[model samples]
Target chain A: MNNQFKKGVLDLCVLTILKKGDSYGYDVADTLSGKIQVSDGTVYPILRKLASDGLVSTYLKESQNGPPRKYYHLTDEGAKKLEADKQEWDVFTKAVREILEDEDK
Target chain B: MTKKEYLDKLTKELGSMSYNDVKDILSDIEDHFTVGISAGKTEEDIANDLGDPKALAADYKEGMDLPKILEKKTVNEKKPKAPEPTSATVCFCVLITVFVAIPAFFSLLAVVLTIVLSEIAVALGGIALLAFFWTFGPFKATGLLGGLALIALAVFGYALSYFAVKYFVLGTKWYIAFIRKTWHEGL
Candidate 1:
């Protein structure tokens, strides 16, 4: 996939993954990269950006493993951003699909 | 590449970024490696899956630069330069202080002094009456009562003078502060 295209939607994908539930940094990376063809490291910068933008907040929670994990939670601001970005994504993909179908004819 | 090798490269690639930002990014990547190892992945495989350190650092720098610039702008806007006092303001303050404030202050001081002096005179008169009665062969009861009454009145007068002097000094201080503020900030 083109790097530019992936870069644009990567934020949306991460937000969608977080909408499912609060998850740790590694889990978020795993979930996102499992489906998308991206480097596992991609999600960290996106998470940091989202957090700094006040869309998400993080806290350390004790895990059954060796140490506490940093979990990211969707703030009200994050949820609102997800809703808006989802709508925009839907319209954009639909328009692109239509353009491809027209070209097929 | 091992986790250490990957992190060192990323840190070098993130050149000129703030220390805290670099630390936070490194910690996040470190956590990823720790979890990957626990999940049955080798260090080499995990490092490979994380992609190039240089590219990752570039993404972070891209996202951060704009916000950092905006943050500085907001901080600058928060404290605008305070206006300096104009020559007219200085002239106005000086003229008012010399002509109006000084004369009023002196008149108030004179009034306070008069009250104090009168209180002292009343007290001295009371003492002199008591002494005159004491020296006489027969001390009159009416004279004794008058002396005690004069002394009580002087005591009350002295209390009133004390309050007057206190308020006069306080009012002058308050006026000076008000003028100084006005001189700097305008009326």
Candidate 2:
């Protein structure tokens, strides 16, 4: 897969994951890497970028076995962005699929 | 490498970034190693999966730079927006300038004058470099030296132009993104 393709959608993917539930850095990276062929470290920069962009906010939560872990939650601003991007992605993929399927007819 | 060693290398690679930025990035990497260890993954395995520290540092730097670039208002933004020009507003401003604002006129002139003079200086410097290449060299082969100088100048100019266009496009894209962000933030 093209790294450029991954880079374009990485922020959305991270946002979607956070939209599902608050998650720590490692778990987020792990979950994404499970489904996609990304480097395990790629998600951190995306998370930081999302945080800096006011799309997500971070807070420390105490874990049972270790020190407090940083967890990311989608901000209200992030929720709106996620909705917008999701709509855009849906429209984009629908158009692409139409173009691809038209060749068969 | 051990987790400590990996984090240390990453920390050093991130030198002179704000203490908080460096701390945040390092802590994230540290968390990866910690979680990997608990999940029965070796430090070496986790580090390998993460790839190069230098490459990761560059990504982090880019993320860190994004906010700085977006928040930076240029000199153009600082200049007051001129009011919509009606005939009455234009005549009143002209009268004010002619009668009451001689110093303001000269200050505006000073700004334009500096810009025009610097532009002339740059043009002259380029012309001078093109005209008198042989004077700098005590070499016997003045023709060969001048030819070499011209080639070097061409290459430098080409590289500069290429980079200038590249950066200009990147800046314009960033500006567009900043504008979109402002619209979204308004909501």
Candidate 3:
């Protein structure tokens, strides 16, 4: 996939994942890697974007691992935006797929 | 850099920004990290998700704009990005005159003056070279010729110094013009 296209989708993917539950940085990296072949570093910038836009809030939770882990919780605004985005993505991808498939015939 | 390290470096580099803006950027970064971690990602993995640092920085720069950055560069900030070229040239010329050129010129003149004065005191420096070979040392043609040569060299040295002062003055003028041109172009 083109890197730019992948980036455009990245923030949406991150927000969609966060819709599941509050998560720390490490755990989020692992989960996203399983679903998509992507660089692990990309998540931080997305998280930065969401937080900057007031889409999420975070707090530090004591971790058994090494340092205190920061946990991110989705704000109400984030949840509403995520819902709209997922709806749009479903229609957009399905339409694109239909067009490409019809071209094969 | 890792996610934590990236944020730290950015914070340090952007020390001049308002605390609130920095805090907002940090919180957003933390949120992204938290989301990634909850998905079971490693710190490196999470950092990778952010994409290239330079590209990200450029995006931030585009959004904030350099004018905004300069606005933040207050008078308190060290070296307030210099004034216009003409003004800068004037300042530079002034500084050079006071610190370097003036001292250099005076010292040079002093040395030349000392040589001239000493030559006058001894009287044998320049004028003695024209001495006659018919006196007590009539057979010492080589010695008399050497003395004349020495006198010629001393006079030549003093004349060279006069040109030095002239060049120094010309330099200050060029410096001022160069400064003004640079400033005008920038404006």
Best by TM-score: 1
lDDT of 2: 0.77
Give one digit per residue, the lDDT tens place, for model 3 in A18-80. 889998765676678678876554565567567768888888888764457777789999999
How good is chain A of candidate 2, measured by TM-score? 0.95
Model 1, span B17-76: residue lDDT tens: 888988999998998999999999999999999999988887888888645643222224
- State in Å the error of residue A93, model 1: 1.0
Clashes of each: 0, 0, 42
Candidates' DockQ values? 0.55, 0.46, 0.20
- For model 3 the local lDDT of residue A56 reads 86
Worst 10 residues of 2 chain B by lDDT: B178-187
Per-prediction TM-score to the true structure, in the order listed: 0.58, 0.56, 0.50
lDDT for B14 (candidate 2): 69
lDDT of 3 at B129: 51
Cα lDDT of model 1 by residue, A46-80, tens digit: 99999999999999999888688999999999999
Give the CA lDDT, 0 to 100, for residue B21 in model 3: 66
Over 4 Å off, model 3: B1-187
Would you give me the overall lDDT of model 1?
0.89
Clashing pairs in 2: none
